[model samples]
Target: MQSDSDRTGLAIGLSLVALLLFDAMGLIIKHLSEHYSPAELSAYRNFFGLVPSAIALWSSRAWHAKGRQLWMRQWKVGCLRGMITTLAQFCFYMSLGLLPFATAATIGYADALFMTALAVPLLGEKVGKARWLAVGIGFAGVVMIMGPGSQSFTPAALLPLVAAFCYALSGVLARRMDADVPSPLINLYGTATSVVGASLLTLALGGFSGIRGPGDLGWIVAMGMFGGSAVLLLVISFRMTQQANLAPFHYFGILFAFVLGWIFYDEAPVDDLMPGAVLVAAGGLLIVWRERQLRRARLWGARGPHTRI
Candidate 1:
């Protein structure tokens, strides 16, 4: 077992790397969007993404008796979660193709706010005024980023909002799931769902007529490899660090995405998006920090009165 300090450092490092990989995956998606429809890209992403997920599952041997039984027990729930995730990813990829990279990414920070809000009714978690205030602040940030009624606002901007809500719901569902179901197994199911759903979507959209030969192969592979590896990195990181400590690091993806957009697409940040992104990040971080404090207090209370020398 790792010492507290060492574990903290490793977790932070791994979290940062994971976020970078996720943002890199986004960059690849954005590039490939020029060549493929969102449905087609999602299908490719899900299909190829299964590669690393399979490898991880096999190497981990998470299919042993109990694990296999747990997986079978949860397959139905997994399918539902996978369907939700596929929809969320499809909306996000659509937004990526339509909106500025940083803006789309910044809007996704709303997932934290949405998760907190949803947990109240969905998970029966009690929320105090301060946490609600934080969520409101986060929403204000989202409104600012979305800039409704502004000349630049497009209906396309709503895509990330939809995606965030779906993702948040999925997060809550995960919390309600059996802890014994391995993450890799869950990932496998999710990718399988995405593959099936996205393929149907592609067919509805008139199939993958946009394929431009072997050049598209690189983007497809990059999307899958980066996305799958990022999931593994996050699983490893979260295993080492507390979720609260890692939560704030997720916002760092916006920064990475901004840099990538500038380098690859020459896309500059929108003036309104930066301040809104800050508000969203600050509000979400405040909520996470407050929750951590509350958890510690509860733990301390459960420990009962202590005598000091």
Candidate 2:
């Protein structure tokens, strides 16, 4: 019975909460990085994260309406996304251990720009000059944060950039999936694959370290809960409204990351994140705005000229 406006407001609120939960997971990952390898953490996260994905799938009315089908026409796409997600988590989690919390997170924002670029070849979508310009602006901001050739820049900085690209690739692949498949089901596929992939990666990386204490174990559980819940909320939000309506708000995560970093780690990398962060946000917002404009144009075109304003 909720109106479109009410659904949009709820979606936006849920999206914000999801972002906060994701940041909370990141905080826990950063805290535990000293005691665990990224591979181990990735494996643990995906393992526990599967619970929420399964629960979401089970709770989906649409999925239930479909007679609880377990098969997907694009199962390969889901598997590929899972593999990519495994790599993304490994790289991002590694960066969280090595870089400033905000720095790693800001760099990860490059995923938006990467997604735009990848959509062209990967999705066969046309890229307009405006969006390409936005990508350039965003890339420049990413480079500013990386600070290559500066003393502050290290090889470690590249980890988050790599992570961003993998994440973007995974997202782009999702668009190639069958539209009829439930998002929660797709998510479950990816998470399950990630679990296996991360486990193998952990074995290859010389295996997991022993937990130092129950505190670390508790933190691991909290990390998985935060991440899994975030994914669930994001899935629900996307279903509630147009993705473009929610896309721009993702930048809020960067601000939250910065605040959390400052509070927890006394990290205030203003000089490193200043105008660059502004440019990054502006570029992403511009892309979102352009997408919305194009969608509206398409809608109007489909409705014909006689449609009411």
Q: Which candidate has the highest lDDT of all?
A: 2
Off by over 4 Å in 2: none
Cα shift from native, residue 276, model 2 (Å):
1.0
Per-candidate TM-scores read 0.94, 0.98
Q: How well is each residue in 139-231 modelled by candidate 2, as lDDT tens digits?
A: 999989889899888898999999999999999999889888889999999999999999999999998787788898889888988899999
lDDT score, residue 155, model 1? 90
How much lDDT does each candidate structure score?
0.84, 0.94
For model 1, the run of ten residues with the poorest summed lDDT: 62-71
lDDT per residue (tens digit) for residues 10-129 in model 1: 998988998888889888888888778888888888888888787766655445645553245677777787788888888999999999888888898799999999999989999999
